[model samples]
Target: MSKTLTITDNRTGKQYEIPIEHGAIRAMDLRQIKTNADDFGLKTYDPALMNTANCVSRITDIDGDRGVLLYRGYPIEQLAENSDFLETAYLLLSGELPTTAQLNKWKTNVTLHSMLHENVKKFMEGFRYDAHPMGIFLSTVGALSTFYPDAKDIFDEQSRLTQTVRLIAKVPSIAAYAFRHSQGLPYIPPDNELSFTGNFLNMLFRMAELKYEPNPVLERALDVLFILHADHEQNCSTTAMRTIG
Candidate 1:
């Protein structure tokens, strides 16, 4: 049987009926609340959004009360134990795990785009020597829009794929550059031979004398960390980023 909520207006002795949607998860539909607010003179409030569900999603699901977390219907424990960040990313974006060939192709595309624009590198020199890495990273990411005009066409499949590759490829370089600037160290360029995390480590920690080497344990741990942070439905920062997009 379907369920409905009845809200009575004291002034006019009228009532508003709201339908309840029941599924694997139960939700109350509230889209019309604002439209009828004047008629009922009703006030809606949920402090800290304790009981509110603001949006719908097909990504991660978190139930704090139940201590459960799922990403694309797979348990967090299973993903953290069995999947690498790139595989998890493939699942999140495409709603399925990628085949070995697909994963390889995606990784190759990312590797090919790993270098930052030379002009962007020159622009970083203008920042104050004491500037924070995070500040520099934020500014440099914003500056990316100017370098990649093709990224503006979000509706184009190839453009979207290219920008996705660029973002994954470039962010590590940008981060490493920011760190190098903060430390007054010469920037270490990406090594195409290294895996994603390995390359980032090379850029972040390599010195004139010492070369960075990838540690299997450390790389796997970092991959799990990235997978864990891949998504959280309605997370404040994620929501903000979506809204901005």
Candidate 2:
């Protein structure tokens, strides 16, 4: 049988019944408790939001008490141990692990897009040398919207996919340039031959050397860290980004 909650009002000696779903009652169900048509019925009183289910995530899940985290039905620990950042990203986006061909294609596309447009570099250079790196990073990302106005087509799947790849590919470049600008150094172009995190390190730290090879241990460490931190279910920053998105 289905479930419901019964409420008894002492003032009028009246009772009310509210249907329940998923072992919970909707706030709207409480509206039936009013004694009169003019009454506002029951209203929320959660000033501290101590009793709230803020959001329902389709991508990730967290069970704090159990110390468990999963991404697309796979435990996070397994992914961190067995997969890299790009593979985890593919699973998060497509809801499954990729085949060898799929992973190769994804890496190739991301690598090819690692270089930021020359004009974007000029835009970063416009900021004062002393500007905060974080501030420049934020403004640079905002400016990216203008450069890819098609990203505004939120309802279109192809547009979203295109822009997601572009943003993910170019953001490391943007961040590297931001830091380099704060120190008044010429920006280093992305090295596509390197891994995703490796290219970012190259851009951020490469000096006069014509070739930069990222350390194997360091590269894998960064990749694993990226996988671990990738999806924090509906945190403050993700919430704000979701609102903006």
Candidate 3:
């Protein structure tokens, strides 16, 4: 027999069988279980989403009971040890790890777009030196939507690709700017020669050095962090971002 949830309305003595999909009953399906035809039936009140699956996603899977997480079907530990952030990001976005040529193209495209517009730099400069870096990052991220009006073309594949690449390439630069601005330091532009994390570190810390070199260990650490946190399905922060933003 096909999977289904047979819900009994004890008050009316009515029973309804709702189709179960992917081992979960849809909340919308419950709307059919009314006290009477005029009644609104049921709504799930899951505070903190303890018993809720907020979305359907193919990217990440979490087995909280077992303390395991997977991104694009790869174990988090495996990805952390074997893949760079950009490679992991490509995997999540494309549903597969990139080939050597594919990764090279991805890296090159991301690097080329690392430089921020002069106006964007000036916007970051307008913030108070003591302003919270998180606040600045959030505000600047919102401001980015205004910078790329074409990103509104949600139906266009190329537009989505463009916006994704732009956001991925530019967010670290803005984050670094936020860090420097909080310290009352001049913002350093992105160094295309550096790796993504390396460029970010350079932007945050390069003072008089002609070439800023990020600690190899820290760079790898950041890459690992990026992989793990890249897509935390149904995390509170993710929920808040979707609700507010």
Give the winner by lDDT: 1 or 3.
3
Q: Considering TM-score, which of the candidate structures 2 and 3 is the better prediction for this target?
A: 3
lDDT of 3 by residue, 1-245 (tens): 87988888888898999998887988889888778778887887887667766568898899889999998789999988988999999999999999999999999999998888888888888888789999999999889888889989999999999999999999999998999899888889899989888888899899999889899999888878887788876677777776465
User: Which residue pairs clash in candidate 2?
Assistant: none
User: What is the C-alpha lDDT profile of model 1 across 67-122, one tens digit per residue?
Assistant: 89898899989999988777887888888888999999878888899998899999
Query: Residue-wise lDDT of candidate 2 within 1-245, one digit each (tens)?
Result: 64978889886778878787655677777776787889988776775456655556679988889999999999989999999999999999999999999999998988887787788888888888799999999998999888888989999999999888998898889999999999888899888788899998899889888899888898889889999888887778766665465
Compared with the true structure, all predictions reach lDDT values of: 0.81, 0.86, 0.88
- Sort by lDDT, best first: 3, 2, 1
Candidate 3 to truth, TM = 0.92
**Range of the 10 consecutive residues with the lowest summed lDDT in candidate 1:** 23-32
Query: What is the TM-score of each predicted model, taking all chains together?
Result: 0.85, 0.90, 0.92
Task: Identify the candidate with maximal lDDT.
Answer: 3
Highest TM-score: give the candidate number: 3
